[model samples]
Target: MSSLSTEHKLPEIIIPEDYNYLAFFISLNCNLKCHYCINLNDKNSARKDMAKHHMDGSDWAKAINRLNIGRDDLPVTLQGGEPTLHKDFYRIVNETDDSIKLDLLTNMAFDPEVFIRNVPVKKFTREAKYAAIRVSYHPGYNDIDELIKKTLRMADAGFYVGIYSVLVPENKEHIDDVMARCKGLGIDFRVKEYLGFDGEKWHGEYKYMDAISQHERKSCLCKTTELIAGPTGHVFRCHSDLYANRTPIGHILDPDFRIEQIFRPCDWYGFCNPCDIKVKTNRFQIFGHTSVEIKDIHELN
Candidate 1:
């Protein structure tokens, strides 16, 4: 992990009233090279930028601690190609303020013993619709038996954990079997709808029809309910902007930065990322929620 200069004062940033979710992309490098990864589905995806900039655990703590997350329903989600890939994974989790709950999305490739010893079970506990530590099961990169063993071990240790798999066309046949086995083992297994194109057709249900069309590009005002933080503490207005390495709206570590709820004009509406426009379940596990809100969807004159 790289150290940031500490000479400057940090800001006491407040969470926006309308903010619904926090996603921290701690690192984009993953152990498993899953072919269906939505993060790598586009030309603008930041696969090359992963190694460029990443903050030390202390810096992450200082910036994230400033956030006043007031709702029990909202949590600062630690995610990445694999968040645990960060060198200070344990320190980051331990250092974040306890008042703000945490959620993690990971692949079960890590040592459970290390995780059990470092992460307190209570830090991840919150009143929510789904598990706090979400484990993504990639059939080709991982085995069901091994993943089950890991999941069971964590659950036995009193952690809020669950297994989820993307329902790709090729994997649809195996999902039911996997779900049944998970149910038999007393695990909370879920099937996630695939979000990208499958060579034949696009998979997910989206709020905007042309927003994700690859060939079309348009201008619009886009607002997001998500507060997205990249590895180096840069905040972005949308997923497309983040992955493309476009100039960030602000940096969390900057003393002057604050969350703004108003919509901002965008020139790449039709080329929006699927993750932002896709219709999916929210923190409450309620369906019919999209990450962003787009208005004035029309071609630039």
Candidate 2:
């Protein structure tokens, strides 16, 4: 792990005026291993070994604080195999600029009392349809009862919290039961569309079928509206590249880093991650939006 000096002022990374999402994978390490983990969805073996250097909380704050988001609707999302697993998770959140809103995606594996004591509620508070602190409830991997207790505890403490779960085909029955229970308790419970294969058929609503087909590699020009940074502060073209540990477009700590909105060349089009190509809701809950766009696709010889 590395830390940034407080005296150094890194160059501003101006987020494109049209950019929709900004994500920082603080640490890819997690406490649970779900069978349907999206980070390991790639056909390649690169994701199996995700042992990479991570930026400490101070450095992460320094790198993130350099961003000029210029929008109130979009918050800097802190996610990971589990973001709370980062040693300085609280420090990173508290040290970030007050002007920047923050969002957290986690599995709720931490102590809620410790979180409430360390985190400021205002930092994660925002006017949105969903909660700012979004917790994923993996049916078999995590306990829904414990999650409900933690969520209610946080909510009572003035934090906006919501619970989400993927609608895995086999787990649908249990998920539905949990959703009803949560709704009865006045907790925000939502279901996400299951992506990837389910033993027999491919699942998910994707714009480009061939992108997630995993059949053959193809050449194409890809562009993204999201600013995705890995644990090492390296910005990737898309989630597919981020999880696969592929080459990065630039490092966040680089003094000259800037957001470039253009179509870049790609050779692994068929092995795309579902999060990039899935037809899902945008920040405004508008449907039919995809994170990355691919064009000029052709068979690779």
Candidate 3:
């Protein structure tokens, strides 16, 4: 993570009009290691290795501030193994342009008092059906009692916070109970569908069935509408490429960098990440949207 040279100003990167999501993986190192973590969906051990080469806060702010995300509805999301784990997390949040709102996806492993003191509440404040700061509730790993206390403290301080947990089959009963308890305590808690395997079968709804089959690698042309940046400031075509540490589509710090909406050749179609191919909701809260569009699919001999 070298900072961009101060001698030259980087060109402004314009976000595509059709882009639905923009995320900066400030750090991929998490305090909690959930068994069903989606970042390891590719089953690659090197996924977390990039955490060491993460661009410092100033570099991240420089790269991010170059973006022209004209729409207020789509905020640049800061997420990772746990975004709060980044050493310069607060600086990155405070340095980003005021025109660009931010959303945080975290595990709530940090002290709320320090977070409230340093970060401005308005940076994450926005109008959305869900809270801007979304916390993941991992049963058995992150204690529910502590999470409840932190959520209450942040909420009382005027920050919109919400807790979410996946509906894994084994934890379904427990999650249901927790959801009820959170709602009763005035916490906005929601249950998300589990998107990985359970040894017996796959548990998610995907647009391309073979993408997550893990049977055989195929060739296809894929185009993505999401802007996913890795810790090293490399922009990837999709989440699969980002987690696998594959050759990036481009670097965010590149002076000539801009969004390319065309489909590119990909040989790892069968090994596509579930997040990219999953039939999920768009920013409008409308269903029936997939992150990447794949075409010209065939087996690679």
Q: All candidates' lDDT scores?
A: 0.84, 0.89, 0.89
How would you encode candidate 2's per-residue C-alpha lDDT over 1-301 as one tens digit per residue? 5433446788788888778899998888888888898775445566545534678888899988999888889999999989999889999999999899999999998999999999888999988888899999998889988999999999999999999999998898888888899989999999999998877888999999889887899999999999999988888999989888898998888787798889999999998999999999999898989998899999886
Ranking by TM-score: 3, 2, 1
Stretches of model 3 off by over 4 angstroms after superposition = 3-7, 41-43
TM-score, cand. 2 vs. native: 0.96
For candidate 3, the per-residue lDDT at 198 reads 81
Please identify which of the two predictions, 1 or 3, would achieve the higher lDDT against the true structure.
3
Q: In model 3, what are the clashing residue pairs, if there are any?
A: none
Over the stretch 38-116, how does candidate 3's per-residue lDDT look in tens digits? 7754356668578667888988888889898888999999999788889999999999988888999999989999999
| lDDT, candidate 1, 1-301, per-residue tens | 3344545657577777677789998876688878898886435436466445688787887777888777778888998878898898888889988888899999976899999999999889998879999999998888888889999999999997999998888888899999998899889999898888778788889999788888877889888999999888888998888778775898878777888888898888777889999998887777888988889878886
Which residue pairs come into collision in candidate 1? none
What's the TM-score of each model vs. the native? 0.94, 0.96, 0.97
